[model samples]
Target: MRPNYLVIILLIFYSCNKIETRDEVYPTKLYEKAKYFQNENISDSAFYYFNLAKNDYVKINDSTGASKSLVNMAIIQCNNGDFYGSIETSLEADKLLRNESDSTVKSTLAANYNNMAISSSFLKNYEESVAYYKKTLQFSNDAENRYIYNNNIGDALILLGQYKEAKKYLELAIFTKDSLIYAKVLNNIARAKFLDDQNYNPLPELNKALIIRQNNKDIEGQNSSFSTLADYYLEKNAEKSLLYSYKLLETSEKIKKPEDQINALQRLIMLDKPNYLKYFKRLTAINDSTQTSRNKAKNQFAVIRYDVEQKDAENKNLKLRDAENEINIIYLSFGLGILIITLIIGHFWNEKRKKSIKIEKEKEKELEVKNTELRYSKKVHDKVANKVYHVMSELENTENMNKEVLLYKLDGIYQISRDISYDKNDVALEHNFSQHLSQMLKSYSSENIKVPIIGNEESLWEDVGDHSKVEVFYILQELMTNMKKHSKADKVLLDFSRENDLINIVYSDNGIGISEFSPKNGIQNTESRINSIGGTINFDTKTENGLKITLSFPAKN
Candidate 1:
């Protein structure tokens, strides 16, 4: 009886305190205020306060609050045409939340990549956009994020002229559980296939997207699908297209997406045919702007390629001139040697003819001296040259020796055998050299290498002597074998022809090429083999194709 009023007073005070506690615990006043500015499309104030609240949440270590703020800021940036800037902020948020092991960070990354892809599409950098969207697909772990990223990739691929690949990605997107994302992917696929002359229409996909948006009460998505579909049908059904376009225009105006409104207005002009001159002017203006931008980019890429080609051509010309000078020096040396030998022979012949009566005793002395020198020269050539050749061939095949090592060996061999020659009087060098070359090619081909020898039956050597045939065959064999082992070719054709006194052997193949012809064993051997007969070899590597070997020989009487 003494405490009844006191207990009643205490109970009232406790109830009021509990209400205050609840209010302090859930203080959504700032969030509500920010949402108002966002809904009003006032981006400047919305971004400022969102940052303020996001910083406060970070100070309090509130990850959920921080994430919401970041998402809202990103959406605002996307609406304001600062797409790349938005992606930068989104990635920062993603990194923070990923360190916290948040699952939603993956979805956020997918969203950022998708936004980047859309911006890049507007820029018409399809390759770069497709690459970004692929990263989105890789990071999107959940079904919904996967569906969105897949659609993003599909759209980029379509713009890149990769319609076949786009179709597969789009179909996979549509099969996902997120009906809204699935519908968007389907629309992209259908439009892409239609543009590519494939058997698919976008109307069904657009309608499906509309259905999902309507059911979910997603007005923005509904407006986008309607606008796209109406623009699509504008060509075939003018009245229906106009009706849909009007609906989209009204919805877009309410949502305050000015770009979508502009698009809808353009479509209306197309379908209704009202203000025809104005529509034509707008389209012309857009086209001119687009073409100007495209020309700038195309010119930039072309300039890079042109500069590279110019440098390459300049280098090649210098090399060719040096090679020509070397060849001239070699020819001059051979001419001088031949002239000296000829004069000596003529002098001796004249002396012998003039002294024929006295030379009977002198002839015996001359014969013995000539025989001794010939025997000594044969012994040196057979033993020293054969042993050197065997050692060089062994070094050439070893993996330990690099290209420079092999080149050094070939140069050494050239210096050592500088005086060797295939003269007409060498009977061993005279034979069916074309047949011998074909047999070598056949052996290479039997080892599962693609080596084809053509023009062997057609004889360019019909009138040429044995020395010429031997030199030509040796050079041809070396060139063909080099092409087979190094060129990685599937087919090789060798053409031999003779025009008057000059004989030509042309060897070409469809394989990887030598850019400007780096000197290899095959090349050195062929060059040495040709030089032995006083012939020349010229070869070139065509860009991205294969090697072309040309051999020229002077026919003897």
Candidate 2:
């Protein structure tokens, strides 16, 4: 009993799947239905089904199926007088079949090229039509299609007024086994010859073509032959011309071709017939009706394309929205994970930063204590020790030392200590420090030495800070004192120039240059003062040339 129940359940599932499959319509079936409607001359129904088949094939990734449907729809559009629309559809089919290997697809591509040629001809683009017809011949392997395309090229060339060139393709088309196409080519060649030369007689060829079309029961071909014959006799034989025009009108009416009917009516009106007014009214009515139908067909095609595009856009938007939703969910999860990890790291980083700051504060306190001790030692050496040495030298010279000399030495000691304790210097920080520097250099100069100052411009020191100005004064004073005591300099050149944010001072003297001289107290003191004000000094001295010192420091604004 359990086995029986399982078998029934499986059968029910299979039945349901079969029903779902049967409900779906295949692209091939849709294409067949479109072809049937196209052959029945129901253009709207044909276009509707062809578009449906094209969309279905695209969904299934079947490019060949879609291309075939596009070609058929192009034919319908051309018949409805939508030449531009037909050309676009044919081009789309050609693109889809570019790399196709199937013989049927190749044949369809050739047919599509031919359709584009025909549509271009109707649009009066004769040159483009001829080019498209040549392309059709290149892709066509069938003799009949090749002959037909050659004839099409010939007709377009004749319309372009190339009578001599058109003869080649017309003669090629005349060799086809298809009697109807052969007859049409004969008529076109006759027209080309007639237009090429005024004395050319096309009556024989035109009459032969008309008889052949009649025998083959080719109604469209017969209509074309009659029209050509009418045009041929229009200027030569009025009676024959009237007769052919009437015959064309009768044939066009029988076939329900309004364009042909209108052309015949216009020819009849031009002939000054007895019932010209009646034919004129009929021509106007047929032209209006034809134009209305063409407009309706164009609008219908536009609406169908719009609807398809709207549906495709809606489907694409739905897919994009779904993808965005998934991306947002992923971002939310990732953001939460990053936030939790950042919080954990930040907690530990805060504790580590606190410990580092505490250690930095203890080191700063130790550095401050060491700096204070160094400052006190420098003060003692500069003040008390130097003053005590001066006192001992005075005591050693006891014969020359008196009460006045002792008082003078004590006063000098008091002045040295006072200078160390004070922050200000009366002479060094004076506004006339530049004058004092000039006088000091002049005092070192004598009859044997020359000191040439290049720049004594007051503006050079205008941007210099007070502390830097005092250092500069003392440095120059110390250099001059050394030159007088040791270096027997002949000439000195001092140049000062301010560039950008720096001051450059160059000092060169022609003196007996010391080769291995050690820096004494004056030189050491000059280096310390220069460094305190963020300045640099370079000394250049050779065996006998001279001493050239180059000094550069930042000019404080």
lDDT of each: 0.65, 0.80
Top candidate by lDDT: 2
Return the number of clashes found in candidate 1. 1
Highest-TM-score candidate: 2
lDDT of 1: 0.65
lDDT of 2 by residue, 132-182 (tens): 999888778999888888898989999999998999999999999988898
Q: What is the C-alpha lDDT profile of model 1 across 57-146, one tens digit per residue?
A: 665677666666666676666555555555565665655555434656666556656666665665677887887788777667777777
Candidate 1, RMSD to the unseen true structure: 30.2
Identify the runs in model 2 with alpha carbons over 4 angstroms from their true place.
1-25, 100-102, 313-557
